[model samples]
Target chain A: MKKISKASLSKSFWRWWYGNLTCFTHEHMQTFGYMWSMLPIIQELYPTKEEQAEKLRTYYPFFNTEPQIGCIVVGITAGLEEARANGAEGIDDEMINGIRAGLMGPLAGIGDSLIVGTYIPVLLGIALGLSEGGSVLGPIFYIIVWNITSIWFQKFIYDKGYELGGNAVEMIVGEQAMAFRESIIVLGRIIVGAMAGSWVSINTSVILTYGLDPETGDKIPVFLQEKLDGAFPGVLTMVFVLLCWWLMSKKKVSPVKVMLLMVILAFVGVLIGFFDPGLSY
Target chain B: MSISWLQAGLLGFMSVLAASTPAALGTTVGNYTLNRPLVASLFVGLILGDVPGAITIAIPMQIIYIALVTPGGTVAADLRAVSYIGIPLAYVTCVSQGLDLAGAEAQGIAGALGALVGTVGTVMFYGTAMMNLFWQHYGWARLDKGDFNVLTKVEVFLPIVTHIVISFIPVTILVYYGAGAVENFKSALPMEAWYMKALFTLGSLLPAVGIAILLKSVINKTTDLIYFVGGFALAKSLGLSLLAATAIGGMFAFVNFQIAMASYKGASSGADDEEDI
Candidate 1:
């Protein structure tokens, strides 16, 4: 009974960790990186050069996902490769490829929403606050905190995938995991809203009319921003964010096009005295 | 505020390591870490000898790209260009224009510059990915001959060449020369210029698009927007800090999780009881 050495497993993990998207191409995506990662495992199991090459070719199929969380898929395949080398029943190229294909889509959704959409923004929101007045504490906090947690989480899932093998899919997609994911998404949405309120600043320069100062006989102009804020704080900003969301989600506008549209809006608003930054040399 | 060639070269190297598709230092350390505007601000600050100034400039850019998620490798904006090329140029512009880094005007300029550079970075992202096809094809040919060593070469080393061509040179040129061009432009057009007003106005409005892109990602149903509006009210109306809002949001999430799990248990137990009968 041949087994993959501990040295080879560690090498495989690190290889995948660093090389997942290194040689990425539009055609093959993560195919080369996946193959490179499996090299150590195939080499250890097959022994002969030609046999190793043949085994390595199994991962040559296209593979791409959120690379950090996609570490688990590599770990599962490593376990499958070990099992196939030991002549396990019903474990073939088709079965392994099937598992890989099946996991990529769901995992991408989870990774994108949880890690990218929610977690990073929350961390950045706090960091942006800390960065008040250009403090180094913010970036330093994010870099240290993000790297440690991300690497730890990736490594944790990788080990779990290896230990449980095919059963790992149940752990990720099970009812308990679904509850956990939903709650996290809830948290994500709330933080996104707070981020909108805190960061995005959209104001109107349009004034309804000018009020004269009766006591000093001076022209006292009433500011539109103050009036709007008195009615609802940052209502204009919220409206603009909602408008952008509506245009993108409902009207199917690309972000770049929407940005160009904002340019036009700003230009027209400026021309009509509806928007002004009030800058001078 | 002008970038020296050496500093530009360093920034260029960072961009090589930070490219999205073919990040030389890998995704975690490269794309997610160095490519982020907040993190890149620290490095740019260190390199340019202006920590406070750089961080101040990067704040608005960071907010604009706070939720830049690249699902299926399609990106709205590339952070390498935003962080490296855009920040440096914006820094020079702010310094030349004598705008306070903390003011809305500076922040607006930074946002506008970052968005413009981000598009350019997207083109370079595709270029780097396409060029790496040559090395991948070569590796495939060698692997057909049962050469295992070629995998390491193609995966790790050959991509560096692609980065040098696609990411490194362009960033170096842009940052190094863009500083002088910005100064010239600042001299030509005062802040009172019509185009400048439009530019800053555009800057203040652009982050809405970033926030909207983020909303599109997390808001699956119409009801999800209620949670968003709730958070907005918490921050805007109540004047709560982000940490305070997060604490409140976390409590809601916990309650939601408890309800979900309790229902899950109830459904399973009901099924079990029916089976027993």
Candidate 2:
């Protein structure tokens, strides 16, 4: 009987890393990719083509997860395959699939929030700032920062899952996950708020002309933007962003609808001489 | 300058690669950078021989989709098409019209076209998703035949081939003809008219929508309001740049995390003491 060696485990790891995304479909999601990744392990362990085909059949069930952080599932399953190859009792296909089904959802949430919700925005915010001056450093900085973190974290979790096996899932689903999630969510909120203040550009040059000065025979110009800024700098930008947020979150307005409303508002505002693109600071 | 046959073909091929990045190939670059309009625009600009012009068009377009997230394989607007197709079309239009890259008029064109192409991208995204179903069936058929060896083909090559065909055709046709079509449409229409000004106004306001989306995703609780407001006020009141504001925000987040950790530790320890007793 062939044993599942470190070489074969690494092969499976590379397969999952590369093939996880390739077979994405509306139906079955990442099932095909999962099966493909299991090929090396199944081929080495089962020996007979028929046994291998039977084992591969179990991977066809719907399986999807956040691929980057989801490497743990693959690593855990590799351990399971190793056990089954050694004729360990009670290590059946159902146990493997059940573990996969249970862990995918929670891991997906953690991965998505951490990587998508927090990391990308924070990095991109910095990159956008760097590139505002048209420096090539922005993209380069973003690429290096994102990849180094992603690759390092992915490998660490993958190896942990292998060492701890199926039981390691408790670490992801327990109180620790909630704390990490809440902290990232809070950080994301603050960063986005700062982004809104700095990035949501709304400036106006709408000066109200009323009443002539008796001494100078000159029209008195009262700048509305000045009063708004005096009340609060970037007040208009905040108001506009909040209005957009309200329209999207509370009002249940679709994004496309919100987009249309903004366009219409712009048109009307410009037509009425309230907003001039040229005057936007 | 008119886009030559060679440039158009090369760009079309590049578009396929761009569309395929997030899923089919180059997942690292695709998800990390190329999926962004700003980065994709730079590549398109470089390929088309106009880097600065492309970046100028890409910044506003980037803001429009800044908070874009494709949670659970569901996408509201597809940025791949927007990045590769929309930005290029906007750049081509600006050049043909002699509009200054930094001018409001050019920005207006980019935004309007970006929105239009972004919506079209939704269709393309669905099209690829739908096409992916065929290869899945092929995989099942291979499994039935007990052909585990060719599973790699079903997983990798099939999707790649399908995506290339779907992306290449539309991208080439659009860029090759879309440029002249926009130029003609621009010449015929009075872009200096009031309505066009309205469109430009709308373009300037689109970032608000993007920011709102960001806020909606990040704000999960009412108490989270302090951080949000504090961050905004920090930048607004002190005139800090985004990088500085992000640093300050990072400090706040770190403090918040420590507090959360402490409270969690206290609660868990209290529970442990009770159990011991």
Candidate 3:
């Protein structure tokens, strides 16, 4: 029985962790990184240089995904490669590639939505609160907490993947996992909304009418912002956010274009007295 | 408020590590951690000799890029540029113009500058990725001949050269010289100028796009807007903080999880009973 050593597994994991996207390209994506990571495993399993190179070539196919959560795929392949070396039946290049291709798409979606979309935002939201007055606590808190949790989660999933092999797919895409993912997304939506309210501020500078004071001969302008706030607080901000969402999501306009449109809108709004920052120095 | 060459060099080196798509320090430590505007604010503050001022300027920039999910490796705004180049430029602009770092005007200017540099950074991001093709191709040729050791060289060391050419030099030059340009621009255009007013107005309005980009990722269905609107109402109407809103949102998520799991169990058990029969 040819068993893969713990040292080789650790080496493979570290290689994947650090080099997964280091040499990323549009054409090859993570293929090179994948090969670099698998080299340790191949070398341990096959003593000869030719045999090791042949085994390493199994990862030459183009690969890319949300690399953080994509660690599981690498772990699964490591286990599969070990099995192949051990003369296990039905373990071939086709089977290994099949597993990799199948897992990348779903894992990408989960990683992008859960880890990047939801989790990081929540951490950042809390950090933003702590950073209220430019205190270093916010960044320091985020740095320590994020790095610790991220590395821990990546390592945990990686180990689980190696232990369970192909069965690891069920843990991620299973119905129960889907439920968990949906619930987390619910939390993400709510948090994003709160982030919008707490951070985004869009006020109108348009004045409705100027009232003349009889004694003092001063003009007291009736501001549009106050009137809008009386009806619905931050209505203008919500409108703009939704407008940008509609333009991007529905109309399929890119974010950069939306930003440019905002610039134009700002210019027009400033010209028409609809928006002003009231700045003087 | 001007950035010294030494400070600019440090910022340049950090940018190379923090570049998205192919960060030298890897993704977790480099891109996700250091590239974040809030985190970068601390380092920029240290470099610029004003921690509070840098963080103050970074707040709006952070909001504008709160959830920069580079799905499929396509980035809307590169944070390396936003955090490093944008924050420094915004800081200099604020200080030179005598604007309060914490004020709306300053925040607006920072947002505008961040968005501008972030867009430019996208080009730099693509440039680094393209340059890496040379190294990857070289690795591929060597692999064809069974030269396995070349993998390490291609993956690690060669990419550093790409970073130096694409990321390091441009960032250092832009930041070093951009400070003086900001000072000149401040004197030329007074705060009340129409263009300046428009620029700040644009700044205040840009975060909506960031939030919208975030909303695009979560809102797969129209009904998801309810949760978003509810969260917004909780914060805007009730004046709740982000943590308070998160606490409330957590309750909803828990309830949702329970209901989903219960339904799934019921369906599965029903299937099992039918099979037994």
The candidate that achieves the highest lDDT relative to the unseen native structure: 3
Scored by DockQ, the top model is 3
Tens-digit per-residue lDDT, A1-281, candidate 1: 77888898888888888999998887988888888888888988997887886787789789998888999999899888888899989988888999999999889888888888788888887788788899999998998888899999988888777777787878777888888889988888888888888888888877778888889888877889999999988989989999999998889888878888998998898889888888765
Q: How far is A223's C-alpha from truth in model 2 (Å)?
A: 4.7
Error of 1 at A21 (Å): 1.3
lDDT of 3 at B193: 81
Across B11-90, the per-residue lDDT of candidate 2 in tens digits comes to: 66766565632355535555546777877776877888877778778877887777765666766677777887788888
Interface RMSD of each candidate, angstroms, one decimal: 2.5, 3.5, 2.4
In model 3, pairs of residues that clash are none
TM-score of each: 0.95, 0.89, 0.95
Docking class of 3: medium
Ranking by lDDT: 3, 1, 2
Candidate 3 Cα misplacement greater than 4 A, ranges:
A210-219, B270-277
Residue-by-residue lDDT tens digits, candidate 2, A1-281: 44677777777777777777666677877777778878888888887888888888778789888788888898888777777878878888799899999999887776666676567777877777666645666666777888788778777777778777776777777665666667767767777777777767787769966768999999888888878989988888888988988887788787768887987888778878888766221
**Model 3 chain A worst lDDT run, 10 consecutive residues:** A163-172
Worst 10 residues of 1 chain A by lDDT: A158-167
lDDT score, candidate 3, position A196: 85
**In model 2, where do residues sit more than 4 Å from their true spots?**
A1-3, A87-92, A203-216, A220-224, A251-257, A260-281, B20-22, B184-186, B270-277
List DockQ, one per candidate, in order. Answer: 0.64, 0.49, 0.65
